[model samples]
Target: MPLGSVRYERVIAASADDVWALIGRPERLHDWFPGITACSVEGNRREITLQSGLSLPEEITVLDDRLRRFQYRIDSPFFPYHRGTIDVIALSDTSCAVMYATDCDPRTMALVIGAAAAAGLDRLTEIFPTPIFPTPE
Candidate 1:
């Protein structure tokens, strides 16, 4: 079967620079990616621990500051063909849009990953709420 994919995006109230600083760094993935409890990276290799205490190995394919894009591939034997990409696009000085995309074989993996990616985007938005100011009456 061919690989399937999905992309999920969310607007975060924090600046793109702030969002990129954390998301672009593979070591801090658990901070906003739900179900991920911890992450460790060395060179281009990464290992992430899930809520179930299961660990998955991964490879960092690209980390471009100019494009604010982060791409990686899951190396688990169960998931032989999987790629994940995240892009932080600036909407304004104080806000940005986070685009999370995933492609995986077995077709069904796309649905599973899409849900996780959407939840992760939601988590990112929740962490950076916009401030509201009162107007003079």
Candidate 2:
């Protein structure tokens, strides 16, 4: 099966720690992520409810606190072949970037996943405050 990956980059006006704080907080996922109605984490597992009333359970596969990166795999009926990681990098004191990437099976599902990625990124940008980076040189 062909692996489909969509990447998005956004410069936020927050420090890497700040962004990570928000992203790492399971309860705050729906605040910036669209379609997610709620999130809960137990042990190394996490569950999320979608706006469509669907729910997904995922296991935390990788969590690198030093690098501020999180990776997980979906194991639920709500999504087919849904697995991804979110990476955050600090650009400066008041600037940072986030990237989300996913790989799934059933090549035909690429379109749907791609659309979801776009919408999710759009929602993230909308919910996040404006960037506070200094004027570029």
The 10-residue segment of model 1 with minimum total lDDT is: 128-137
lDDT of 1 by residue, 56-79 (tens): 899999999889999999898898
Q: Give the per-residue lDDT digits (tens) of candidate 2, residues 43-109.
A: 7888889888978788888778778888887786544676777787999887678777777665444
Which residue ranges in model 2 land beyond 4 Å of their true spot? Answer: 77-80, 108-114, 132-137
Q: Give Cα distance to truth, residue 77, candidate 1, Å.
A: 2.0
Residue 108, candidate 1: C-alpha displacement in angstroms: 1.5
- Each model's lDDT comes to 0.85, 0.71
* Model 2 accuracy (lDDT, Cα): 0.71
What value does the lDDT take at residue 49 in candidate 2? 93
- In model 2, state the lDDT of residue 119: 68
Q: Cα miss at 64, model 1 (Å)?
A: 1.1
Error of 2 at 81 (Å): 4.0
